[model samples]
Target chain A: MSDATEKEGRGVRAVETGLSLLGLFLDSDGPLSAADLALRSGLSKAQVHAYLVSLQRGNMVVRDPQTGRYAIGPFSLELGMSRLLTLDPQITASEEALKVARKLGQSISIAVWGRYGPVVTAVVQANDQLLNSAQPGTVYSVTGTATGRLFAALTNEAEAREIAKLQMAEVTPPRYVGACPPFDEIHEPLETVRRTGVSITYSFPQPGVTAISAPVYNFSDELELAVTMIGPAEEIDISLEGNHVAPLRALAATISRKLGFIGKASGA
Target chain B: MVKSPERQRGVQSVDMAIRLLEIVRKESQPMMLRDIAVSAGITSAQAHTYMSSLKKFGMIEQLGDAGRYALSDATLTFARHVIRNDATLNANINVARSLSAEIQEMVTVDCLVQEQPTVIFAVQGPRTPSLSLRPGTRSRIGNSAAARIFDAWSDTPEMNPNLSRIIRASGYAHAEGTPVPHLASLAAPVFREGALVASISVIGFPDAMAPEPERPVLRALLAAVSSLGGSSA
Candidate 1:
């Protein structure tokens, strides 16, 4: 390699070493001292300290005077907030939702947790005649909708109970093709969702309309949104192991991965 | 210019990279290639090499048609860990949120950063009108109650002996209608592990938040401070 290329190669290694030091903070339970970092990284204490001082000058890391341990600082906070600000889940999942809808010949809707309950933020119709109530900005009833049951099942128990009880008071029971359980008896359906990792509503909101929903998670493994496949009851299979259900689950996991989720096994 | 001790010990490439980052942060705006090179006292070609390295690391990026470089959100992953991993700051932020909700007044938590009191967390109370002291807002010693609380507890020569004594005796400071007319604030120092670490304050109208011992707000503020083991000092 030429002299210029050799110098550039060395510069890349330095940047990689600095970033690896910062990356170590992500794994640590709390603030770490230079000695702790040196142990974790296999670098000498002096080398770690020198790199840390440079990182500190950039406000990439901050050293506490009292404990002499280092933590992430303000500059990184601004960058992180900026990244969060630009995350439009609706936009991120729209193309994938549409692709899945085409593959399965079913309509799809994306739902996010709103103040009231699960609120539908976007929808992709498989065809013109796919009559469904999954409209943009429509708030799904926790005791009434498939997307609602998914959130009510997976969220913190206390919060899920509150949301379930709140919707029980606000919405009236919808007529079902089959004899549906009373609105107050929602525990069984929510339990099913928790066990199956998906929710199925069979022709409750509208006669001949059935929908199956699964959750999409963010980097933190928190339930960020729900992706639901909607269709006519006769055409859609609502069983957990049915042909359509597995694809829906796979699609949800794919979108979750795109959003930086890593907790779940890939393609599981 | 003399090299600081840190510069003497630090890696040359890492130092150059940080100097560029500091320039971007201080400018608070996207900068062109030549400008950054001139400020760092390096050639444009040399600046380009460092800038390329920073971009590859996701620390900085070029924006719009101008190709001016600025900090990127790539560092947010690291930032998230930084904010989440600090136990003391994290616990106090939770306290600030709950106390503001319970009292229906804007609550702010601040600590000394380079001797200036800087707000690290703030929750607006429902009852209080708008207050501008968001996170990262800074104040000098005499500007606000949080700043004064830090000054009172520290042994710096600029510390007022009488004010320090008063604050130490009461465990809080009351600022009534001085910083902003008709606005009042009551601040208490937060101590952890037997050392003064931060200050928490409630801000609102003077009538609702009077600076008196009998006032329920003062009692509540003291209660919140004690719950955190912050009243030890």
Candidate 2:
């Protein structure tokens, strides 16, 4: 190899080893010791020691005083937050969700279709009821909740079927099999939601709870998020003509508009 | 300028001392001199010499009666200095400070680092006790509000799908008197673009943050986060 190539190769190897050491923390159940890192990274304890020193200098890792295991340092936290700031949909939707929740005296959840399913991206709750509602980062089931139904209505048929399959597998306590509807039964409601552009469900996923969800579109007019309003069934009216439906639709529309949806498309 | 061999040797000693510090930090617990020497690939005698110098500089300290060594307060001070200077952390700290002042409750900004929820910045409210707002504290992902937010938004697979669903539906996590006694915490996620970046939490005594009073605090926190996030974005 040329001298420059050799120098670059050495640099890449050093970075690889350093990155491998950092990667170990992701799979670790807790903090890792140098010996543990050495054992995992296939590096000698001495080499691990040197790498640890470099990581520490960069503030990439920290040692717990009580456990004596190396954990991610504060610098990594800074980087993680910086990366999260670039997600425009979450920032825009979250601000709107908070405002709607306060105005309606209900809980609002904004969810995006994640690889796992519909993952909640943001949530805001009005006080005086359901203070312990769904939190951000929670995932919704395609078969069980309003948000899920909304996603099932908007998502592609093949992906929706895959989510449905996962949901079927998720129904625990085989004896409670009757509680989870068959796939065919699920399709009817999803089809209705797709046509109407809104989903209102009661006593589903949880008893005595009601949820109303509408879709938010992005610049491409794809289903980017679902905004849902949830509360107790007794207090929240889920009827088509109820007080919450119009405002909920309006909020979802407002967010969709913010996302550059001009409302030209109907199915989205 | 070329250094004299003596000055070069001095620089090597400083490097060795830093290596010793790294070994102690890697263990995550206090380490004995023999173990430190073995980890650093130095003799116990050499390790002792380096430890003495590091202790003199307040970078390392000896535990009582035990000959074990650990990073000292000075090391944490250095870490705190880095946190203060970091751009993202500085902005979060300012938002946390303003929120704390407005709500009169301790506010913390936590992020997922190495898949662990760790606090990077904290501002204690006037009424809150000094004991709780330490930066760099870690909480269990399943139990704390901040950890739950990180878990819910992170691409990592969920540990409990049911809990994740509930947290997603709720939009915020609340743990009453958990991770700390007599302290209840409610945390909301702060997003940038469409990704969850961090969680801003308000912690206070349960009675002080009762349902009625907490409404305003939650509203203020959401408003503060929205404003801060808008500016930062």
Candidate 3:
């Protein structure tokens, strides 16, 4: 019998079926097809398939190349990452980011690439009443900032330049974000990131806030992700450009290892 | 890469079940039980039974205002386990064999099933005596490079909480064959989307596999796996 026969239920049947199919993935280790979804969701096959096609086009789902089963995709990853950061990106990042925030006294932040410049993921607060309220889920701009260069490195020159344009157009003073003078300084630092494999920036996103940013790597020897800690000038380590780089570098490397990059020794 | 082990004396009901699934995969839209039965060369009664069970598992979906059947999202899980590990062995075997060449040992590719390490395939060099570690034997997740690779590839947050850190710190791992002390093995993890899913290992007698160009061999082996996959998550 069709679910429509039930009292007080009609269109809701399919929506419930759709949600139930997504729930099945929690029990499954891999992908699932329409049939699997129907079986797991206990809905009529037609209703589930329709919702899936719509989900696929919207980037809410991913189709497996081999099995033709569907699962969560990049959009989901972005959402998942956002939620994780909200719960204290510092905790998700674990001990080192926490340590950096505490030493600095000014609020410290570690951010990664999100739709906005850098999405502040983890944060360590300072004692001051000024209260820099940049929360974990907040997105920062690539222009006129430290994490900006790291975000720039995520893409090629053209993409960064394009991002710079959009950012400046949206902010005050209305000039090219790339035209910011500090941006010119980033070219050399980014090159160092590509070479020596780490980067450091001064008085980063906001003036009076100095920062250090580093890339986490693994056995693959690829600079796939970046981590940055930003805070007020007094608590920031200017010596870090040389003396403390290894700590941040080591922390990034450790995070990279945890993320499964394990570098040269692992066959990469 | 190794295919799933073929089953023997499999149930007639299971065969019909698979055939029904295939029909849905091939069909453009939902098919009624009659259509499914005809396609699978079975009676409608049998097809109805299969469909009833399949519907319970989320593998098949019903379509239209009326009841017709098609594929659903759940089948991908079964396919991923096979497909993900397929490349793990294919791109890795030659590299593992070549690495084994310098030490004149046996090279093998392995994966995990529920953390039970199993040799999926192996190639023994001429200098070494043929080893008994054949494909399809399940082993402990401890004491082998292959196990480390499997644990590393797993997405579970606390995979191998005891040794994961050590394996990460050390890079690649070595096995003195705690499972079999005479056999010394070395393994490296293959990562995909930032998770370790497979391992390639070279194994042989400790005396015969003396320290001869092992690092270069593993490096070459790792490079080969990287060619087939992204370096990190």
A best-first ranking of the candidates according to their DockQ comes to 1, 2, 3
**Alpha-carbon local distance difference test for all models:** 0.74, 0.66, 0.54
Docking class of 1: acceptable
TM-score of each: 0.62, 0.42, 0.35
DockQ (0 to 1) for model 2: 0.03
> What's the distance in Å from true for residue A125, model 3?
1.9
lDDT per residue (tens digit) for residues A1-268 in model 2: 3554544344445554665676677565457998999999889987887777667665667766677678767654443332222226677788888887898788888887765567886778785776335677676766667887787777655565676676677635421111345556778789889788899887666778788999987533357788888888887777676788878888888776654444432221
Ranking by lDDT: 1, 2, 3
lDDT of 1 by residue, A94-171 (tens): 878999999888899998776566788899988667566668877777767788778878865555566556555544
Per-residue lDDT tens digits for candidate 2, residues B86-203, read 4555566677777876776778888665567877666555456545344456777655778887777667746588777776666677777766677777777776656777788888
Poorest lDDT segment (10 consecutive residues) of candidate 3 chain A: A80-89
Off by over 4 Å in 2: A1-268, B1-19, B65-67, B126-133, B157-159, B166-170, B180-182, B192-195, B207-214, B230-233
- Candidate that would win on TM-score: 1
Predicted candidate 3 versus true structure: per-residue lDDT over A1-268, tens digit per residue? 3332342133233333443555566556556787988877776786565566545543446777687778764333222222211222234355555665555444556665543456666666645635354567766657555566765764445556666666766656542222244345567767765666555566644566666677754212333345665556665565655434656676776665433332432232
| Two-chain DockQ for each candidate model | 0.27, 0.03, 0.01
Residue A92 of model 1, lDDT score: 69
Better of 1 and 2 by lDDT: 1
